[model samples]
Every structure is written in structure tokens, then in C-alpha cells.
Target: MAFQTTKQTISQPLLDTAASLYCSASPHPTLKSISDQLKSQGHLDITPLKVRRLLITAGVYKSELASQIQSLYDSGKTITEIMGIMHLSRTSVHSYLPYVINADDEETEEENLCQRPISLEQQKRCEQAMEQFQKDWKGESLWEVITAFAGCTFVTSKGLKFTYEVKQNRHGEPTNELVISRKEKTVTKATVIKAYEKLLELSAEDSEDGITADQAKESVPPRFPIPLSGPKKLGTFGASYLYPIFIKLGLITEYPMLSYFHLPFSDDIV
Candidate 1:
């Protein structure tokens, strides 16, 4: 969201661009005036409609806007529903309705609400993250590594179960980058091996050893579960000492830290 800049400076190119794209949707006073001011600053007279068409033809505008409108119409999504998700007022979004909506599509059973398609900017960020992860990872099996990063569920071809963070680029290329993030912690596999090696070395040292791998007291994988005798809450002390170490070592197989709980936090997500 920070990438969407404030509207007061000479760096008003983006505002100009957004206003320019208004014709592809609908004309608006606020949008029109903003466009005029921006063009005037360059000492040129430009029509709002002309700027609007330029965006539709080319020059870094979102490709999916028209596609989303078409999809919504086919699914019987009303003009009101489209405007709500896009944060546009009813008047603005509906202006282009006659051009795109089809009689057959209009007759289809429509849902009262439709989630907005994910924005182009979000798609870009996802791609960048994937590229960076690939650049950093030296492992042979990359998918397994990235799947762990996102704290999401994944079922394999042969029915093997795993998880990951999935992303895509503008051209619809997908990237599955694991979450090795200390804050996000959805990663597993090799990162875990590296973390395990570090912790194991630390535990095995003759000096002030932080961890001691006691014999199987329970069937848990890590073997050394710290004992805190009390009822637990979300993000409990049990999670703190244990999770940080597992995360730092990159051995954490669980996507969300809270997934270990009896009731998953999925309910909390909309």
C-alpha cells in the first residue's frame, strides 16, 4: 500500500496515470480535475478521454480490469457488487456497464457479492518474492522448500501432503517460494536441516550448551520439549523458546506456529 503514493508533490506522475485511466472505467469530477492539473503542469492541453484511451492501449496500466468486468458479468455479478470491491462509487463503475455486459450474461444467476480480483501490484510483489527466494536457495528440490514458507496446504501428485506460499507474475507465471521468514515461518525441508545442524552443534558443545537432547520422553520430533506447567494461550511460552530455535535453524515444518494448537487459526482469516 505504501507504494501507492500521496498526491501532493511533483512525483504526481502516478496520480496522473490513475486519473488518465479513468476513461476505461467512467469519468469523475475528482478524477477529471486531477488529470487536467497534471497535464497543465507539463504546459500541454490534453483531453481526459484521450489520456484514458492511452492507458487502455498501453503504458503500464492493469491488464485485468476489463477481464474482471467480463468475468463478473458472466457470473451475473451486478454493477453494484463490482463497484463495492473496487472501492469505486456506483456512478463511476456503471458508466462502462452498457459496453461490456451481455444480455445472456445478465440473465445468469448472480451472487450478491464478489471478491475483487487480486490487484496487479500484489501480483508483482509475489513474483519478486519468488525470484529472490530462488536466487538465495541452493537446494535441488525447490518446491518443497517454498511450499513450507507460506503456511499453506499442498497435496502432491501421489497424495503426499505439504504446504507453501504461492505467488504469480503479470504474465501469469507462478512462483512457489518457501517462507524462511523469522516472522512468517512457513518453511521446512533443507532450511530445517541447516537449522537442525546449528542447534545440534550448539547442544553437543562442551561449553555452555543451550539445548540438551534428552531421550524420548514423548513422541514429538524435536525430542527436547521444554516443560512449562500451566494452561497455554495463543503464542504461549511453549511456542516462544521452541519456535524461535526451530525457525532460526530453518527446520520448522509447520506453516503457521499456531497450527500446532487443537483449534487452527484459519477461522480468524476472512
Candidate 2:
């Protein structure tokens, strides 16, 4: 197909050509190859970067960083918020954003007000992104998981609840916030963390002597540890979800697990 371009944008035929070359090619044509092909078809200004830009705009590009940015955006994060959470520059975030969000755009405003629920596919991507972030995270921010699960509400086995949402700060920029509640009373994130630590402490005391193989086989499976009476009371949510995350991020130690011992069968005898 003949490729054409205008001063501001490449023609649909040209964009479609780039998409096809990159998506349908057996060995996967490189941007250079696509550029050459387009140039041969009378579009001489085509360069590798332009070809890449076209593919990116067409949503056919498979860039890890770009996908990460798009995923964050899909999760209701603003450009500035994405930059802060990802440590990326504004230009970098904008270049990879899958959708446009013009300031005066009526649709954008309406969408923001509506705050569409995160779809399953988007949720899966967000979860994967959060996992990756956790792996690469340093001691930078508290409640970093909020980045991926914004606009989500999670409930614990008990009545405690956790909500991850974004709100405008004093500077009129979007920022992540975590809210915890139980029995209609607000709880602080610090309070939750401390309570979890205390529970771990208590659990550790319960297992301080450690369990032998015989004891482990006879003992019933242990559920999450929770403090019965204390100023810092971690409900079911803190014990199950928050505890594991704390262990993973290295913010707290993992509770010990009893090792199982199996007996040899009769076939093992000589």
C-alpha cells in the first residue's frame, strides 16, 4: 500500500502499514525495515524513530516501560502521579501513555468524574506491575501497593476494611492515599503496621521453642496470628494480607513454619 503523511500526522494507510509490518511479520520486521519499506513506497522522510512512534500510537508496540505507564494510567493515575510513583519524567510518561487526556476535553472530565472500575485485564496487569514494583522497591514510600490498586476496596475476614484511592493534594495534584477502618472508626496505616508487628511478636513467642517433627504432625494447622488484647489490634486483614506483604518487602520477619516429616514405607526395608 502507498504510504502517505501530512505535516502533523501520518495517514491511516501508513499507520496501518507500520502496524501490519510489526505485528504480522514472521521474524518481526524491525523499525528500520518498516522505515525502509515506507520510504521505498514514496515516503522518504520515514525514519526508525518515526516508525516506532507510529507503532506506539497504533498501540501495537510491545515496550515494557510503555506498557507499565499505560497500565498505571488505566488504573486512574494522572501523569504527574505516575511520574512520582514511577520516578519517571513527565515527557517519558506522556510518550508512552496509551490514551490522551486533554485538559479541556469533556470526555476526559466526564471519565474522571465517573471513575470507571478497573477491568479484569487491567487488574491483572496492575497486579503484575505491583509485584514487579515490590521486587524493585527500596524503602521509598509507605503503602506503595496503592499505586496499582487505586480505587479498590479490600475487606478482611474480620470487619476491618482497606481502601486505596487517589485524591488531590494541596498543590492540586493527584496523590495516593490509603484509608483503613473498622467498626466505623478510622484507623491509621502506622497503627496497622505496628499492630501487625506485635502480632508477629506474639506468634514468635508461641513458637519460640520451635516444633519437632512429631509435634508438628500432631499439631493442628495454625491460622494467622492476632493479638487478643492490645492497643495495636490487627484484625483479620492485618494478620493475613498485610503480614505477608510486610514479610515480602522485608519490613518484618516471616513467621516460622513447622516442617513436616514423612515416614519410610515398607518397600524401603532391605
Candidate 3:
């Protein structure tokens, strides 16, 4: 058999447009946006994938941060620590690392045979479990459940384990369950409330406490303790464990302007 190769040519004008558009000061352009611009301005129709390929060929899409992430990994930083510092996911951190191979390249027939695709029934069960987990993990119902199941340990999605110690009144009836950390410290619920109050106070002012509305807008919920002294400072670990629970209970709002913090599933930290 004889083999023949055909060469595919891309016009210089198209290359120039892609380069100019990609390097522009405007926000990072998506492939779809780049394709749209090329079609409108260059009068050439192209797909987003093709635009991506052209950019890659031109060396316009550079992995500048990948090297830095790899350097951190080489310096003995854990994946969780790297994710925390870079505000990236575990998968993303792994992707940025130099030695990790692409998933497609790593896939094999044996692995495929061993791994079963999730059945519809299994998927439904998973969805229900996730839904129930979310529902039971936070809010007034969570507090109720904790009071009912005092002394039982529960784990969060992030694998943070905690339990509630039942606080009894004079009649020996359980009044409230004190959130207990893995370190055995009692977390004061009032501290979490106070942190939210501080956030509210800061958010209410136009420019007070050195926190601007824009800064508050970009802020994640405080990690707890609220930088205060005494009992508030005691539960840094415990308070963090209950922070999500407080948010669900409407005790800690994200900001004064916003009613509640809609926690993201991707948030690895509780």
C-alpha cells in the first residue's frame, strides 16, 4: 500500500487576527468569542475548537501558572494547601502539575472494563443521597437533628468530623448541643453570630473598617473566631466546623446586602 499526505493551510490573515485578538488587553477571550470575532471581522467562519487549535499552534495559550504550581508541588506543598493558596480545585491543581498525564492518554481497555458506568438507578440513589446530605447537614433542621442525636459524630463533605455535646438545663432536659471540634474544644455559637454581625456592620458602611463593598463582594465567609479575644478565640477549629451549619440556620449571612450564602459544591473547605 502507498501512503500520501495532504497539507492543510491556514491563511496568514487568520493567524494574525487570532494573535492580535488573543493578546488584546480585553478580558481573556473564550474560543467561541474568538471565533465570533474572526467571523465578523475577518469574514472567515471557524469553530471554537479550531480557534483553540490555532491559538495553541501560535503559542498564544501559555501555561504561565502551571510552572509556578509545579514549583510549589516540588517544594513539598500538599494538594489541599496548593488548592487553598491558588483558589483552585484538586483536579485543576493536578492538571497544572507537570508530571500528570491527560486523562485520555491514561485510559486503557482494562481500566474501562473494571470501571462500570453508573446506572440510572445508581445515579438516582446518588442524587438522593447528595440531596439528603445537603438538607440534613445545615439549617434549623440540622440543629434539631443534632439536639436529637447528641453525642453522635458527623462528617462534612470536606471530611471534617465533629459532634455536638448536649447541654442540659436544671430539669436535666437537653437545652442546646454545644458543637465540639475534633480537638475537643467547645465552639461558642455566639462567636459565629458576632462574626456575621461584624460583617454586617462593615457591609453597611460605605467605607469603614477598611473593607469596601467591592472587597466584601469578593469575600468568602470568615473562617471563624472573628479575630476576637476570650471565648470567641477558643473555638477556631470548632467554629470552622459549625460555620456551614450557622449559614444554613440563617445565623450567619454572607453579607448585609445578601440574605444567605449559597455555598458552592466545589468549595472544599467547610
Top model number, TM-score? 2
In TM-score terms, candidate 2 sits at: 0.30
C-alpha RMSD for every candidate: 21.8, 17.0, 14.7
Q: Which stretches of candidate 3 lie over 4 Å from their true place?
A: 1-64, 70-178, 181-183, 200-270
Q: Write down the RMSD of candidate 2 (Cα, Å).
A: 17.0
| lDDT agreement with native, every candidate | 0.35, 0.48, 0.46
Which is the winner by TM-score between candidate 2 and candidate 3? 2
Q: What digit string (tens of lDDT, one per residue) describes model 2 on residues 1-270?
A: 001111243366777888988888665677778888889999998776667666787878766666666786775554544554455555545545433224432112111211346676656655565566445432223344434545544433343445534445799775533433333333345544454445444554556567553443233332232223322234533354454334222333322322222211111101
Q: What are the per-residue Cα lDDT tens digits for candidate 3 across 207-267?
A: 4457764455344442221222122322444545554443322233222221123312221
lDDT of 1 by residue, 125-214 (tens): 535544553454322323333333343232322333343344445786655334432344443344434433333333334224243433
The predicted structure with the larger lDDT, 1 or 3, is 3
Candidate 1 has a TM-score of 0.19
**Model 1 segments beyond 4 Å from truth?**
1-129, 132-141, 153-270
Task: Please give the ranking of all candidate structures by lDDT, highest first, separated by commas.
Answer: 2, 3, 1
> Model 3, poorest ten-residue lDDT window?
106-115
**Superior by TM-score: candidate 1 or candidate 2:** 2
TM-score of each: 0.19, 0.30, 0.29
